[model samples]
Structures are given as structure tokens and as C-alpha cells.
Target: MLSALQLHSRGWRVSVFDSGSAGRESSWAGGGILSPILPWNYPEAVWQLSRRSLPLYDALAPELAEATGVDPELTASGAMLLDPDQIQAGAAWCAAAGLAAPEIDAILQTRGPSLPGLLLPWIGQIRNPRLGQALRLRLRQLGIALHENTPVTGWLRDGGRVAGVDTAAGEHRGDCVVLAAGAWSGALGALPVAPVRGQMLLLRAAPGRLKRIVLDGGRYLIPRRDGRILVGSTVESAGFDKRVTGAAREELLAFAVGLLGTEAAGQVETQWSGLRPGSADGIPYIGEHPALPGLWVNTGHYRNGLVMAPASAELLADLMEGKPTQLDAAAYRLGAGRL
Candidate 1:
């Protein structure tokens, strides 16, 4: 969606083909954290992408809201990292990133009594579904063709370049092609992408109870403005099976209860799952295919797709236009072997 929007803004005609409805997959299902849970843990590639994308989100949320008359409900709600190891690493990470490092007691007192943690005041989040809606609305306003429920069965190649795509309807050709097919990119052939199933639990808390986004252990709790807190998630290599298993639900509930106590966990509203497009390495494949000319790929962004989307699209647009980019574009090329 970002790619199409950017391309359209540049006076290029764009058409988006989704296997299902747009924003129905990982983009909608995610907790919408603008930054990674542990910013220090990921590789430089992830950091670079997130750094660029983060600022874009700050500008975009309100811009789209005003333009499309749909508020994405972005909030600088901040975050509480409730792990001793992460807390220990916080100062160094902050120093490296040139961010503030608050005292652990201050963080615990302000945001929690659960455990020792780190306070990140600059972090923000968005209501992802609303963001998607705003994007779709804006795209329509821009005259971009959105083909929902349109599945691209295969690519239409002319000589060595990608001519277009073969859909159920017919062949829809274009000047360039971007394969941001998400988890289903595996069906496009040897792309080293697979589906990683993640199950999430939504629980309701009183409006002022849970103050901010809390990352405890490996699980995260994202509090919404409507007193609904989203507790997630379990990263499992369950292939394309998006089924919400009882065991996973129970496990998530247990984790939520453990972190925020039983009172918060009892108000279970709903549970769901999404298949993230896991790449060969944790880093996403974001440049043109080495072997396939005129064929570009912007998928393979496993768990961090939402946080990485803006910069990924920006980098992709730079490459597509043969313009100078802020980040090293060659680092994300589709070469063999892992990062």
C-alpha cells in the first residue's frame, strides 16, 4: 500500500492486487508498535529501516487523517520494557542510539510495579486497521486501482523482464512490478519465504488501568484508547495454518495474567492469529531480484512488517526510480546465503 501510494504520488499509475482484502493479514493483526520491542536486539538493517520508517509514521498518521478524513489514532503512548536483561542493556542501547535512559525505579513507578524495566518516552503506536482504511481511502482518492480479492496466479514475463501478472480475471501488465505478496510469496517460487503463525489475545482493561505498552519476557501488551488492551503473541513455525489453537490461547492468557495480574486477564474479549512472512534471515529482502530483471520484491518482512513498511517502501521507491537513497540499498539484495 505504501509503495503504491508513493509511486502514485510520483505520477506513476499504480494497481494493487491483494490475494485477499488489503490490510486483512499481518498489517491489520499487528500491535502497531512503530518501533521494535527491543530496539537493541535487532540487526543494523532492521534498525536502519525502523529509524527511517518511524519518522514517516509521525508525519503520515495525521497527514492521512486530515486528507482522507479518517484518523489513524496514532499515539505516542510510550513503552515499558519489563525484562531484567533488557533493562540492564538499556543504558548502553540508549547511549548508542543517542536517546534518554531513565532510571529503572522511575519507569517501574510510572508505568508498573510488575518488574524492573526501561522507559522509552519517544515510542508511539497506531491503530493499524484505521491506518489501512485511511490508506485505501487516500489511494482511491488518488485514482489508484485497488483490486481486492484479486490473486496473482503467476507472473507474465516478456523476454527477461516481468511484463505483468496473470490473475483470475486476465493479464494486467504494467511498466514495473513489485511483489509485496506477504506470506503467500512462497507460492511465487524459491524466494526463501515461509509463513510464521502468531496468535494474539485481546483483553479489556479499565481506561486508566494499563498505562502504556509493556514488553515483558517475550510477550507484549498494547493498551488502546478504548480501554481495550491487546496482549500478544506467540511466534511459531506452524506453516500456513492460521488456526488459533487452544494451547496457544491458554499460553498467551497465562503470560498476560502473569505480567498484569489475573484481574486484567479475566476480561478476555477475543483471540486471533496471523501468518507473518518469515524470511530466510531475520532481515527482509527489499531490493530487485539479482537474477530477475525488472522484477522487484518488497516482501519477506517477517514479524516487523508494520514497523518496517515505510522505509522499506522508501528504499524500494529509490531503487525503482534509480535515485540516491539514505540507506545502503545493496545490503538487502536477493543474494543467496543468510545474513
Candidate 2:
């Protein structure tokens, strides 16, 4: 997206194709943790993406909001992760990373409903829906055409190079086809993008409620500035079925309410599910297609799509521009017959 925006700034005619409405997928569905509060459950590469892209938003977001006239709400209000024994481990992680540990809750507060936690001062978040809208607006303003509800059916080939993409609306021609189709990517027959379903809940909170994001174990609470808290997510390989089950919803609600009390219990305004495009290892696939020329990938971000967008775009932009990649593209390269 950052690259598309940059290229648009340079007067390149860019077009985006989505199987569904653009940006309505996990891009908008994410919890919007701009991150540093990321759990130790993630790998170093994931952490590296989080560490790098978290700060890039500061430089690019205002420009994007100004250019698109959309308020992609981004804020650095710090974060807190709790899990009793894990809290001490997290403290070491934060301190080792050179983040400012606020004296707000230095000692381990007795585990009330949830486990003990500490606020990681360098963390941040964004309103993902607002960002998707902002990017769509920006793309439109830049004269970028988008074909929503029309997805690539297959590839129309011409020997070594990819000729065009076949969609439900018939054949759409492009000099190059970049796959940003997210989870449905694996359905493309040649793309390595696989669907990883994640179910999340949107909760309307009481006034002056939870101050920071609280993530304990696998569950996370992403607080918006508008008093809405996004509690999510279950990572499951349930194919393309993006169904919101009663089990996940019940467990998530019980967890969040356990921390913030019963007042936030009846505040569940809505519930939904979306799929994160994951790879075999959870990093995004981002290089030239081994089978087809003039093709590249930008999917398989798993749950990190929103946080890694800027960096992912940068890597794609670098490759598309024939510039050297700062990160190793070896792992990201499409393997033989693996798309």
C-alpha cells in the first residue's frame, strides 16, 4: 500500500483487484496493534516487521490522511500484556528492547480477573477500518482503478511471461499481476497464499473504560479511541470457512469481561470473522513467481498484514523498482510449482 501510494505519487497508473470489496478483509478486520506489545509467541522476523513498520506509520500516516482526506486513526498510547509468570518475561523483553517502562504499574499487581501485566511504553495501534478507507480513497484519488467482487479466476499465459488474469467479469489485462488477494491466494492455483481463519469480536465499552491494549496469552484487547474494544482472535486452519462460532465468541467474551468486569459484558455490540492469509511459516511471500515471469506475491501475512503492510509494500516496491532488497527474499521466494 505504501509503495502503491508512492508510485501513485510518481504518476504510475495502479489498479487493485480484490475477490471481495477492497480492504474489507483482514486488512480492516485486524485488531490494529501497531505493536511492540506483541507476544513472545511470534518469531524474530515477525518481531522485526512489527519493530520496523510500527514506526513507519508516523512518517506516512499523516501524509496518507491528508492525501486521502480520511482519518486513519493511529496512536502510540503504550500497551500492557498479562499472564502472571509471563509478565516478568515480558518485562525483560521490553527493557531489552530499550522501550520506556512507565512507573504506572511497575510491581506485579495481584492477578485480579486476568494475569499480571506491564505497559510497554513504545507500543501503538491504528483504526484498521479507517486505514482501509483511507487507502481506498487515496488509490481512487490517484486514478487507480479497482475491480471489487471480481477476482482472478486463473492466469492467461503466453510462454515465459504472465499475459493477464482471468476473473469472474472476464479477462482483465495487465502488464504484470501482483497477488495481494490475501487468504484466497492459495485458491489461485499458483499462489502460495493459504487461508488462516481468525474469529474476532467488536465490543462497545463503557465511558473511560480500559486505557490500553491488554493481551494475555492468545487473546488480545485492542482499544479504539472511540471507546470501542476489539477482542479477538483464534488462529485456526479451518480452510476458507470464515465462520464465527459460538465457542470462540463465548470464550473471548468471558476472557475480556473477566478482566474489565461485568459492565463491559453486555457491551458486545457486534461479532464477526475474517481469514488471515498465512504461509507455511507465517511470513509474507514477497518475490517473483518461479513459474511465471512479471509476477510477484504479497500475501501470507497470517495475522500481521496490517502491521507489516508498509514494510511489505516497501519490499515489493524495491523489487518492482529493481532495487536491492534489505531483507533476504530467499525464504519469501516462490518455490518450484509452489506459486
Candidate 3:
């Protein structure tokens, strides 16, 4: 949808085809941390895309809310990293990236005292489901053709140069075709994308119980505006299985309770899972395909889809238009080393 919106805004006729309902897939299920969970852990490419995309939301959130009457709840609530070991590296990364240095703190009144953690006050988050809702509405408002519940069966090939997609309803021909199918991109072609299931649990807590996003180890606690705390997530290699297992529920609930104390033990509201497009490395492919002319790709975003969406869309648009890109487009090309 971001890609479609980007193209549409640039005076191009755009149509979005989804196998299921728009915004009900990975975009809705994500935790919506605007920045990478652990920026120090990801590659330079991931950070490059994230750094460029993060500021775009400051304007986008309000634009969506004003246009669609659905607030995405973009918040600068900041983030607390409990990993004391990464403080030095995190500080260095912040310095290099021109971001404010993290403040060293030992105690969060809500979660109690612990080893001193890094408090980054600039980190932002969005209510992801609401963002998805706003995007869908905005797409409609812009008069972009949105074909929901329509699965593209295959490519409408024109000899070597591609033309458009083949759908069950009929043939929807276009001058260019972009594969932005997320985890399902692997099934369509020789792409290196696959489904990696991640399960998340939501706990109904007091609105003020948890103030900031907390990251401990690989898991996180994202407190929403409506007193709902999102506890996520387990990274399992289980292919395409979005089942919310009891084990994952227990594990995520335990993690929530462990951080927020015993009062959070029975606050479980709901549990769900999403399939992220897992690539070998975290960097997504955001350029034209070398083998198929006029066939572009914007999949393989793995875990950072929401974080990198805006810049990814812009970068893909730049490549498609043969314009100078903001970041080095070579890093995200199809034949680039890591998919």
C-alpha cells in the first residue's frame, strides 16, 4: 500500500491487489516500533533505511488522521533498553547517527529497580492496526483502485518484458508490475523470502502502568494509548504457521509478568501471530528484478517492514522512475549479496 500510495502521489495510476483484506496482514500484526528494535544489532543498510524513514511519520500520521479520521497514535513515548551490555555500543551508534545519546538510568518506577539501562528519549511508536486502518482509508480517499480479496495468480507476461498480473477475476494489465507480497513473495518466484512466524500477546493493563516501550533480550512490551500492553514476540522458524500456540502464550505472558510484576499475570486480553517475510539478512530487496524487465520488487523486509516502509517506498519509486535515490540504491538491488 505504501508503494501504491507513493506511485499514486507521483501522478501515476495505481492499483493494490491483496490476497486478503488490505491492512489485515503483517502490517496490522506488527508491533509498530518506528525504529529498529536493537539498532546496534542490525546491518548498516537496515539503519540507513530506518533513519531516512523514521522522520516521515511525523508528518504522515497527522495527514492520515486529518484525511481519514483515524488516528494512528504516533507517539514519542521513547524506549528503554534493559540490555546493559549494549550501552556503550548503543551510545556510539547514536553519536555516529547524530541522535541524542541515551541517558543512563537504573530504575523505572513501574517495573522496579534493575541494572542501569539505556533510556533513549527520541524513540517513537505507532499503533500499527490504526495505522493500517488509516492507510486503507487514505488509499480510498486518493481514488487508488484497491482490489481486496483478489489474489494475483501469476504474471501477465509479454515475452521477455513483463506487462502485468494474472488474477482469478480477470487479467489486469499494467505497464509495470511490483511484487510487494510480503512473505508470500517466495511462492510466486525464485525469491529468497519465507514466512517466519512471530506470536504476540496483548495484556489489558492500566493506561499509566507502563509509560515507555521496554526491550529486554529479544522480547518487548509496547504500551498502547488505550491501556493495552502489547507483549511480544517469539521468533520461530516454523514456516507459514500462524497458529497461536499455548506455549507461546505462556511464554509471552510469563515475560510480561516477569517485567510488570504479578499483577500482570491474569491480564491477558488476546494472543495473535504474524508471518514476517524473513530474508537471509534483515535488509529488504527494493529495486527492479534483473531477470524480468519492468518487474520490480519491494519484499523481503523481514522484521523491519513498518520501520523501513516509507523510505523503501520512496527508494523503489526512485528506482522505478530512474531518478537519483536518497540512499545508495545498490545496497537494495535484487542481485545484491544478501537477499
Candidate 4:
């Protein structure tokens, strides 16, 4: 959808094909944290894409709301790193990225003395479901054809270059075809993309009970404006099985209450799972296919699909249009060797 929007904005007659409802995958099930969980841990390339995409989301949400009349609820509610040991590394990463350093959360430390945290005031979030709705609406307004439940079975090959895509409905030919099919990208061919399942639970808490997104250990809790707090997630190599296991639910519920205290324990509203598009080397394939002409991929984002989608789409569109990209595109190519 991000790539479609970007291409459409650039005057491309765009058509989006999805096997299921838009955003029902990781995009819908994600906690919607804009920044990476830990910025210092990823490759420099990942950080570069994230740094570029993070700020774009701040404006993109409102712009969509104005254009599509669906408020995505993009919130600069900030985030907290609930571990003192990570402060130095997080600060260093922020400094290297030219972002303001995270501050010591003295108040959280005062309350939870065992786990001191750092405050990153610039981190933001979006309500994923609402964002998905807004994107669909915006695409409709732009006259872009969205073939929901229309699975692209394969590619429409021409003599030398290429034609477009083949779907269950029929051939939806275009100037270019982008395979942003998320975890399902592998179904078309051996694209080195697989599904990594993540389980999450939601807690119904009082509004304003939790102000900022909180991360501790490997778990996170995202507070919504409507008093729904999302606690997640377990990264498992569970293929495409999006089943919410009981063990995961129990563990996440305990983790949430452990951080927010037992008063918010029994308010567990819902639990679900999503399959992230895991790549071979943990980086997305975002360039033109080496073997197939007029074909491109923008998947393998894993957990950072929401974090990296904006800039990924921008970069993919730039490559498609033969425009100079904002960042080097060499690192995200599809095939092994280069030209």
C-alpha cells in the first residue's frame, strides 16, 4: 500500500493485489511502533532506512487523514527503553543518527527502581488498523485499482523485458509489478522470504493510564488512545501458522502485569498472532529482480515493515522511475551478484 500510494502520487496508474484483506497480516497485528525496538542493534543500512522513514510517518498520517477522512491516530507519544544497561548504546546510536539523545527516565526509575529506563521523546506510533483503512480509502480516492482477495499466482512474461502480473481474476498488466506480498512472497517463487510468527495480547486499561510506549527485555507494551494496551510479542519460526498459543498468551499477560503491576492483570481483552516477512539475511529485498525485468520486490521487512515501509516505498518508486534515490540502493538488491 505504501508503494502503491507513492507510485500513485507520482502519477503511475497503480493497482494493488492482495491475497487477503489489506493490512491483515503483520501490518494489522503489529504494535505500530514507528522506530525500531533497539536502534543500536541493527545494521547501519537498516537504521538509515528507518531514520528516513520514521519522520515521514509523522506527516504521512495527518496527510492521509486530511485526504481520506480517516484519522490514523499517529501519535508522537514517545517511547521508553526500560533497561539502564541499554542507555549508553542507545545514546550512541542516536548521536550517530543525529537524533537527540535519550534522557534518563528519573520518574520511572523512582517508581520501578529495579528497572531504570531511558526516554526517547521523538519515537512515534500509529494505529495500524486505522492506518490500513486510511490507505485503502486514499487509494480508492486516487482511482487506483485494489483487487482484494485477488492472489497474483505468477508473473506475465514478455519476450525480453517483461509485461505484468497473473492473478486469479486475470492478467492485470502494468508498466511495472511490485511484489510487496509480505510473507506470501514465497508462494510465487523461491524469493528467500518466510513467515515468522509473533504473538501479542491486548489489555483493556483506563485511558491515560500509560502514556508512552514501553520496552523491557524483549517485550513491549503499546498504549492506545482508547485505553487499549497492546503487549507483545514472541518471535518464533512458526512458518505461516498464526495461531495464538496459550503459553504465549500466559507469558505476555504475565509480562504486561509485571511491568504495569497486577491491577491491570485481568483486563486481558484479546490475543492474536501475525506472520512477519523474514528474509534470508534480515534485510529486505527492495530492488529490481536480477532475472526478471520490470519486476521488483519490497518485502522481507520482518518486524520493521511498519517502521521501514515509507522509505522503502520511496526508494522502490525512485528505482522504478529511474530517479536518483535518497539512499544507495546497492545494499538491497535482489540477486547475489551485481551488474
Best model per lDDT: 3
Who is ahead in TM-score, 3 or 4? 3
> Each model's C-alpha lDDT?
0.84, 0.75, 0.87, 0.85
lDDT of 3 by residue, 1-339 (tens): 889999998988999899889988888899999888889899899989988987888878899999999999999888887776787788788888788854565345334465677777778899989998999999999999999989999988888987999987789999899999999998775689999888999999888788899988789999999889999898988888888999999988888888888889888889999999988888898888887887899998989899899899999998999999999988788884653
Task: Itemize residue pairs with steric clashes in candidate 4.
Answer: none
Native-to-model Cα distance after best TM-score fit, residue 322 in candidate 3, in Å: 0.6
- Residue 8 error for model 2, in Å? 2.8
TM-score of each: 0.96, 0.90, 0.97, 0.95
Q: For all the candidates, what are their Cα RMSDs to the real structure? A: 1.7, 2.6, 1.5, 1.8
lDDT sort, best first: 3, 4, 1, 2
Could you tell me the C-alpha RMSD of candidate 3 in Å? 1.5
lDDT of 1 by residue, 218-328 (tens): 898898888798988999998888889899889888988877787865789999999899987668888777767777889888878888898999899888999999899
Residue 68's lDDT within candidate 3 is 95
Q: 3 or 4: which has the higher lDDT?
A: 3
Residues 247-269, candidate 4: write the lDDT tens digits.
99989989887878898778988
Find the 10 residues in a row with the least total lDDT in model 4. 102-111
Ranking by TM-score: 3, 1, 4, 2
Candidate 2: lDDT of 208? 50
Error of 4 at 88 (Å): 2.1
Report the candidate with higher TM-score, 2 versus 3. 3
